[model samples]
Target: MKINLRKSLICINQQKLIAIFLVFMFLGFTLAKPEFASSYSINNILCTMALYGIASLGMTLVILTGGTDLSAGSVMALSGVIGAGLLGKAFSAANPVSLPFAATVLIALIFSGLIGYLNGIVITKLKIAPFVATLAMMSIARGLVYVVADSVVQGVSGSPITFMNDGYSLLGQGKIGAVPVQFIVYVILFLIVFVFLKYTRTGRSIYTVGGNIDTAKLAGIKTNKIIVLTYTVSSILVGISGLILVGRLSSASTVAAKGYELDFITAVALGGTSVAGGRGSVIGTLLGTAFLAVLNNGLDIVNVKSFYQYLIKGLILVFAVCADLFMNKRVKKS
Candidate 1:
């Protein structure tokens, strides 16, 4: 009982320390500009975090397999274009376009998932570098976006929902009392992925395959299949992020989600996922995502130039890597 009590106290202390640090950090920014800390402003920041967080969760899994995805942003663009095209006629209609919206999202998700599976196949069976393979896929996916959105937004509301704020309010624009719909969605995805990875056999296989392909294979794991499945799952998450972005914007362009892959990768790395692969935590990635989001949000509130934001983000990523290296060296020495 005494040991358990001491353990509980240590856990509580850690939680409080982290909470205090984060709270004060945000508070510092808010203090710089009181209005920036307003409820609505905070909500908007969190809303954007939702979209990126979901995408990062998927990317985190992929990186865990000693592989990285450069095609994530392109996948998001392609999915958005596909969904927008399908909503062409129904976009601006007075009635709810949930049917087409649902179908478009479904198709987009399935399409990306297929592409991910292909990535796995090409890398594992064809003996291609995951980086080179994903890079090629990125270019191809981005090109497809241009092809699909050639003409561009005609006159559609591009608005997927109309009933809640004409389908623009809740889930996208509508808040649950005070919370944003996207925020809730992101939380659900985070929890689900976190649990699935921590508790499931298939999910655990990812770490195994990533740790050592030969060892995993000898242990009777279908390494190739696992690799393919990981990519597919990651792609599906990108599709979901795309749909949310479109829903929020009420429009989609060929250029949407450009450079998102960098942000996704950076978030993963900041969360302690080794770029070389096979070491990361979903929770860490989530915290990393939040840290980035909060940084941007806080800076924006303080009126920092966008240019500065870019510079700062790059610096933070470097710092995270350095810290990771230092920790690794210390552990080795010990």
Candidate 2:
């Protein structure tokens, strides 16, 4: 009965639970460290939300389709490096020839999306597992970043490319009045993706495919195409995040975005997205993103050590996954 009741609550009030938890966390943090409630702190958390939220939205889509992209962080790094090489000063501080900002962004996105497309092909055509395929892609993409950066810099094999262009910086650092430009961009992207998932035939197909590919095929849905498109869309969103991160840091390195996949996956899982696929919402992901942003900020404000933070986050992920499994089992039994 306790399990049934817990499952009932989760099924009916998953988003509400997330919202309540976020509120409690905020309140608790504010009480613990009054500085956490400061305007600057609030703005910082919001910016972090925008950054992680955008990528988490993409992860939500892929997770909903019963697949995961471990390559997201590496893909972002590759895209950021490519963008730095193009729109910012050349990879070398010496040559320093910058291209049009729009063109550079366009090229980076295309390249990242292509990587995702290839990942999809390997999974669909070669019948490889999503985990193995994306893991291989992650290593390949990271290595490519080193190769590309070294080629551009001519001596900087492992050094970061510093590109502090005003236009690039504006994307991550600029404000519209008091609101971060990145946050505004994140909102726009979120709305667009939400609408697509809610209203489009292809979007519906994604859910069907994830739920049961054989059933989806029987229904005449192009399961392979849907899977591929989900991955491609995910990588494009990762590119957006990479571009913003590069703008924020004013540089790109092969090491950038390392371990970001953990954060993304954690946010998606906490948002109530089933790792088994076929159930999730973009809005839930936003809330989940906000929850982590606040948690991290709170920890920082309270001077929590980095090691403890990692431990806490890891434990939370385990708990979230266990909860998901329990809920899924209940659903199946019912």
Candidate 3:
């Protein structure tokens, strides 16, 4: 009983530490820029968090399964361009097809899921490393984005596809009272995932697979299936993010969401998810996403240079990774 109680306390303390760090970060930023604590700025941070938080949730699942999806950014761009092109508006491109918003979104998500399925198949059936398989898919997906854009977009080969649809725009711009719709959606997703990971059999299998694939196989868990499922879910979530991004900007560029995978991975890592896999929670991810959102917004509010921001973010990622490795080593020693 004492051991169990101690374990619970440790878990609580870990979460508390993250919360305390966030408080300090908020206070520090507000001190640097008084306007940082304004309602508008706070709302802006939540909106940004929602946009990236959805994708980061997916990344959390993938990392928990001992895998990574380098193709996420490309998938986001591809999904956005595909969905926007289907809208068939006479903005930047003159698409001929005007499907219903729901249909367009479904088709784009299906395509992204297919890409993820392929990535999973390559990693599992072909016995390729997750990194190599996803790296290839990243290139392939980005190429497809360019191909899709060139085929639909009217102007230059690399032009952005722009459109305006009220129904579609609501996903990004709609607000209830003072809260952004996207942020609400993000919270809903976080709750659903948190419950799923904590309560579902398949979710439990994912952790087992990540913890030890050989042991999982011995225990009759279909490791490959879990990996594939994670990849598929990750891609679908990224597709949703892509659609939201397109709605937010009213444009789909070939370069949309470039390098976003790094941000997603960073958030997951900062949330204390193991890079080697098996242990983490959606709650931590939510806090990590909020931290990033606040950090970026605060830096912008303070008029920090882009280069410094990049450097600072990079250092934070490095520290998080090192801390993770250190903890893992200590656990093994114990």
Model 2 residue 188 CA deviation (Å) reads: 0.5
Give RMSD to native, each candidate.
Answer: 4.8, 3.4, 2.4
Superposed by TM-score, candidate 1 places the C-alpha of residue 170 at a distance from the truth, in angstroms, of: 4.3
After aligning candidate 1 to the native by TM-score, how far in Å is the CA of 115 from where it should be? Answer: 1.7
Instruction: Give the per-residue Cα lDDT of candidate 3 at 318.
Output: 76
**Best TM-score goes to which candidate?**
3
lDDT of 3 by residue, 1-334 (tens): 9977865554433334556668998999999889999999999999899989999999999999999989999999999999988888738566678888898899999999999889888999998999989999999999999999988887788789888888668988888889988888888888888888889999899899889999999999999998998899889988989998998888899999989998898888788887799988888888889888988999899999999998988886676556546655654575
Q: After superposing candidate 3, which stretches have Cα over 4 Å from the reference? A: 1-15, 90-92, 320-334
lDDT of each: 0.76, 0.87, 0.87
- 1 or 2, which is superior by lDDT? 2
TM-score of each: 0.85, 0.91, 0.93
CA shift of 206, model 1, Å? 0.5
**Superposing every Cα of model 2 onto the true structure, what RMSD results?**
3.4
Candidate 3 worst ten-residue window by lDDT: 8-17
Error of 2 at 128 (Å): 0.7
Candidate number with the higher TM-score (2 or 3): 3
Instruction: Using lDDT as the measure, name the better of candidate 1 and candidate 3.
Output: 3
Error of 1 at 218 (Å): 0.9
Per-residue accuracy of model 2 over 40-123 as CA lDDT, tens digit each: 998899899988888888899889889999999999999998988876475355545568888889999999999999989999
